[model samples]
Target: MRIATWNVNSVRQRLDHLLGYLGAVAPDVLCLQELKCTDDSFPRQEIEAAGYHCNVHGQKGFNGVAILSRRPVEATAGLPGEPEDTQARFIEARVPDGGGEILVASIYLPNGNPVGTDKYPYKLRFMDRLAAHARQRLAEGATLVLAGDYNVIPDRRDAADPEAWVHDALFLPETRERYRTLVSLGLTDALRATTDHAGVYSFWDYQAGAWQRNKGIRIDHLLLSSRAADRLVDVTIDKDMRAAEKPSDHVPVRIDLR
Candidate 1:
């Protein structure tokens, strides 16, 4: 099966790009983040017409996420251990693959800009909650694929100019340490597992000619649980999507599993 994740930025604004991606890539399962719309306002009709079942967890104008699968899915909204957190940033689903099923999550982790503010703490707390949840799920022996825009630069090599992001929330030492803690829990970063090559990136800024200079970062990712990692075949960043008209700053990252 092929699974892919993309932030899209805003689903309404990039509907055409999304449709084109769906037609071209045709992943068995697709996890989407930053939908920027309500569930009722989601373009379900258009997506369904394209032959995917939609499971959306959406907010009005900020964070939102969804799962689209070629096969029917059973979905759960919201990340566990955060009943007070109302942001629609997470959605998990059970997708059938052959005779078994895999758990897939669409996650738009907090960007946590302006490091001194409350946002950074919230981002760290969210990571803690996510790690706890992942621990429980893995203990249960679930084959899991946590795919999305993590809003993290896991390593210096992930960024074109690492110094430029030294003061940024995404590249701070605390942030990367928490990311490493999560990965230490037996999750294989699909791309790094495939290749150690630098300069491979999944996102570029829309301003300052970032894409033109190849100043990009590999933040969008698919982290697989040990059982799921065992089936991993290939991983690709759909870099061309960044060059499309009205393109999202982020592109898709896809993984193939046997």
Candidate 2:
């Protein structure tokens, strides 16, 4: 199975670029974040016509997520479970086939920019909720895969310039610790499992000529449970996608498994 994750920034703005990549790479399952559209605005017909079934959880303007799969996707629950925090940031789905049932989650974690602000606290709180949810999923004995723009950098090896990000929200010690706590529950960083090298990035700043200079951050990721990671074959970041016309600030990170 091939699963891919990308933060499209705004699905409507990058729909063309997305369609082109979908045709070329053709992952069995594609998880998207930052759709930046209301549920009604999601282009369902266009996506369905491309031979994939989509399960979308979206709100207006910012922070949306969706899962697209070649097989039937049974809509599951959204994360955190707080009725007041319904910003469409999480969605789970099950793809049932003869082999078994595959559980996939698409997430858009809080960006948490400008540390020492409300957003930063929300990011930490959100991480706690995510950790709890992951623990529940692990207990269910499901072949689980969680993919998305995590918005938190796990370590110095995952960042372009570690010094520059010292005080940034993504690299803050507390935030990183929360991420570590969650993954400690038997989830593997599928990309890091294949290589130990640094300077591999998935996102670049549009305002800073970061892409041209190759100054980027590896924020997006595919973290899988042991049940799924055992079958991992390959992991790749489509850096080329970042150069596409009207491309997203982020690009796709793909994992191929048995």
Candidate 3:
């Protein structure tokens, strides 16, 4: 099975680029984040015509997520145990691939910029809820994959200039610790598990020649549960998409499994 994740930034704005990718790469399942549009505004017709079934969880102007699968799928929207949390940042589903179904989530983790504000704490709380949910799913013996623009830089190895992000919310000690806690639950950071290579980035800021200089960060990820990771075949970052016409600041990260 091939699963891919990309923060399309704005699905409407990047629809063309996204269609191009669907044709070019053709992942069996594509998890999308940052839709920035309401469910009614999602390009369902275009997507369906391209031959994928989509499950979208979106709000009017910001923070939305979706899961697109080539095969049939059953999906449930939003993160569990956070009824108070209304942000459109999570969507989960079960997609079959001949052998069995795998649980997949398209997540748009909080950016939590401007530290020391309410946003930072929300970010941590969100991670905690997700961690709890992940732990439950793991206990159920599901082949699970949590993929999206995590918005956390994990480690220095994930950032081009680690010092530059040291004080930023995404790389702050507390935030990184929360991410570590998630992985400690036995989720495999698929890309990291597949290779030890450095300088492999999945996102580049549109400002300051970040893409031109190849100064990017590997924030977008496809973390798999052991039940799924055992089938891992390869992991790839579609860096070429960053160079495409009116591209997203981030690129796609894909993982293949048996």
Candidate 4:
């Protein structure tokens, strides 16, 4: 099955591009981030009419997520982090594909910009929570696949210039360490698991001529559990989406699992 993730930036603004990509890719499961819409305002009918079931966890105008599936989606759950945290950053569902089940989740992890700040602390704490929850999911022995915009540059090679982001939250040592702790729990970075190329990226900033210069970052990712990783066939980044009219800063990343 083909599974994918994308941070659309805004659901309403990129609806046409999103529809086009979905039609072109035809992934079995699609996890979305940064929907930036409310539950009532989500274009469920439009997505459903395209022949995929939409399970959405949306908020006002910031972080929101959704899972679209060609197969039956069941056992939906929201907020693997905490109820007190109360951010529409996570949504998980059980997708029935042929003989087995796939636990699919869409996540919009916190983008803490400044390094020494309250938001940075929150980001670390959030990662801690996510790590704990992911470990629990790993213990369940299910084929778990978590996909979305993590807002983290996992390594120096993930960014265009490592020294440029020395003090940025996403590239801070603590942040990278926390992210590493999560991945160490038997979760596979599906893209890196497939290839070892540098300069391959998923996100580029609209400001400061980032896209024009190819100053991009690999913040968006599809992480697979050990069982799921064993089935990973191929992974790709749809860089062409970034060149579309009224494009999102982030594009799509897909993984083929068999």
Candidate lDDT scores, in order, read 0.94, 0.89, 0.92, 0.89
lDDT for each residue of candidate 2 in 1-258, tens digit (9 for 90 to 100): 899999999998998888888899999999999999987999888888888898889889888999989988897657864667877889888877466977889988998888878989888888899889989989999888989999988889887888889999999999899999989999999989999999999999997788998888999988899978999999999999998877899999999988
lDDT of 1 by residue, 9-66 (tens): 8999999999989999999999999999999999999999999999999999989999
lDDT of 2: 0.89
- For model 3, how does the per-residue alpha-carbon lDDT over 130-187 read when each residue is reduced to its tens digit? 9999999999998999999889999898888999999899899998999999999999
Off by over 4 Å in 4: none
What TM-score, over all chains together, does every model reach? 0.99, 0.97, 0.98, 0.97
Candidate 1: where is the Cα deviation over 4 Å? none
- Order of candidates by TM-score, top first? 1, 3, 2, 4
Q: Which numbered prediction scores highest in lDDT against the true structure?
A: 1
Candidate 1 colliding pairs: none
Candidate 3 local lDDT, residue 76: 92
Candidate 4 Cα lDDT to native: 0.89
Model 2, runs deviating above 4 Å: none
